[model samples]
Target: MSSTRVSGVVVTPVAFADPPLLNVVGVHQPYALRAIVQVQTDSGSVGLGETYADDAHLARLAAVADVLPGLDVYDLNGLRQRVSDVLRLDGSAQVGGMLAIQNPADVVLSPFEVALLDIQGRELGRPVADLLGGAVRTEVPFSAYLFYKWAAHPDREPDAWGAALDPDAIVTQARRMVEEYGFTAIKLKGGVFAPDEEIEAVKALAAAFPGHKLRIDPNGAWTPATSVRVAKELAGVIEYLEDPTPGIEGMAQVAGETDIPLATNMCVIAFDHLKPAVLADAVQVVLSDHHYWGGLQRSRLLAGICETFGLGLSMHSNSHLGISLAAMTHLAAATPNLTYACDTHYPWKTEDLIKPGALDFFDGSIRLPTNPGLGVELDEDALGRLHEQYLACGIRSRDDTSYMQTVQPDFTRNTSRW
Candidate 1:
């Protein structure tokens, strides 16, 4: 009956593609594929975890395999502490900090802990939400990210226009996403696309999706002054502006200058990261992506802290695939102050990465899966196919910085990927 019996950890490459049936923007991406980590116990229950960064991350995880391979499987808390130990030793310091001696990498530990959490949930015979505490709600509302470039013709570069996006196209997609995909809330990609363009796009979207929540992500593409001007300009048009300024102080400036909620997603990765942003009252939404701030358990802890502060919590998605999506859904289900809808990345994709029905959206909402563990089964065949594709293309390097430069949307230099 013990869940702790150790089996082994297997990490593999997966080039997760969106369901081909759905196309956004114009790029039918095999977007950025992530490495999937599976932790299987002697009991035959397998837990899933994914590393979203590039291939170099796999090397980072390799450093800690020896430390984890034979550890007791049932002790989730101990596994968490072990991961912390690795991060302390191998993690990056900050802002281009050097890797410390024997410092186990933080990126590696993230997926490691995720796999362990998956295993823990299986052993406990409950969803990860139950393992965290309990569920606050079974279903979570969704907010769609409308990346203009993805829907535009390949020749139409929105970033080059310094902020101009196609008005007619914006209106068309807004209507389609809401009506076809059941998206109740939407976040328009702003900044690098011109300021006027961003404003116009929002105006068009607002007109189309009224009563539906709307927010703008400049990706920190504007100066504090520009952010203020724009936030006020779109006053009644948008619900909030995410990372308007380049950093935390800029967010405070924007928040102070306007009534629209200023969401700080890029500034905080953990509770400690919240200090500067919260002290400045720079944002209303505390957006934390599990990949950045460790994993699910830690993210939930941060959400609780936000609750105490009367701050909003929206889990930021890194345009990730199934496993991460499932994990986030569980966290959202458990959190108490989850008011705003977080971005749901799966339904927007062109392909089914995992089971066909891991998470389903109905009329703009996704229910926390009631199934055991993360409630979705993994598709080994699809994962393998994508993995081989990446390998064949010789694009499996862990160097995501290079990959990003090639594919990232045209957000101004000020845009931040939190």
Candidate 2:
């Protein structure tokens, strides 16, 4: 039924400007890395994909690309097999941070899978959402993903988002983001301060925007006791508590004590983790990241599993640019069970690799990109600039703790330190 074949593939690693967004691991690096994937087909159509650009992951992508040239775009099964065969138990390290799984095959397969889907959509003259079943909603809403931060990275000029190290400053940051993006929901990246202090910040956000839905993720910094204490303290103030502590047993312990539903991109990261998590009643909500879940189709499968298990579904994000945003928008638009506003770091970045006007936020939602394929194009000049930024930035991979130590000499990365 199909004639076009993959003619070639290009994986370009790029780094974009980032601010001092603090979290559980430490503060973000000055530059965030991503690999832009372009899958060119024999019929003269090109498809785009984006993913994490760690050195090991880049090597995996390059290995897959070697075998991709002659494969059929429709044969995503074949593509996945090639990735698995190449990466067979070699590099299954956790990517980016604590919430990730040790599945290099899926992490490696993600971008290439997205690119192939883009090619399929382009060949069929349909948006990627249609390939994923079809859009259940015309517009996809995203929450204001707020972070506790310094006004600037060390030794750099202050960025537009000023320091948000306390309750008042956090409230100020939330207000500015909501005002600019029209986001009706907000999530604070916590674990940077003491438990009560962070609780105070949540109360401040609640007071500032009484109409908005609120949530916080400490990235598993607290013990079960502290998690329950915060849950009871903010019982009606917040919608859900996310990753307050690590692992299923601890999460189940906290869930047992609180009525506020527990959510995570941590414990339930992989398919095998699902059964144990369900058995322990660890997580109520699972934040799906296609980048680590083996891309869109498998993400839909993940949604189905969550629905069947009576678990809520939402999307997770990383510090990324327009291409990742476009892919996320299409996937969210098509998934019926993804009811909550997805999380995004789109507002935090000062730069992007794709040309503008294809995606924009209105009332905190991006309307479905109806053009063929991913509905976004690479700005050649911008791509080159970001690639150069990648080269000269002198950072090979993301090491938030190491970067943070350059400023905070005694910085410790213990997850349950509190």
Clashes of each: 27, 0
Q: Against the hidden reference, what TM-scores do the models get?
A: 0.85, 0.98
Best by TM-score: 2
TM-score of 1: 0.85
lDDT tens digits by residue: candidate 1, 1-418? 3436656777876654432111111232334567788887777878888865354566556556646766776565776666666555533432111111133344456677777777777767788889878998888888877665443223443222122238777676667677766888898766545678778878888777778888887667677888878877898887778877666777787788798887866666545557777788877888776776667777777877888787887867655677888888888888778778987665455554587776777777778887878887888887778778667655453332333345655512334322
RMSD of 2: 1.0
The collision pairs in model 2 are none
Question: Per-residue CA lDDT of candidate 2, range 9-85, in tens?
Answer: 99999999999999988999999999999999989988899998988779888998898888888998998888878
Q: How much is 170 displaced in model 2, in angstroms? A: 0.9
lDDT of each: 0.67, 0.90
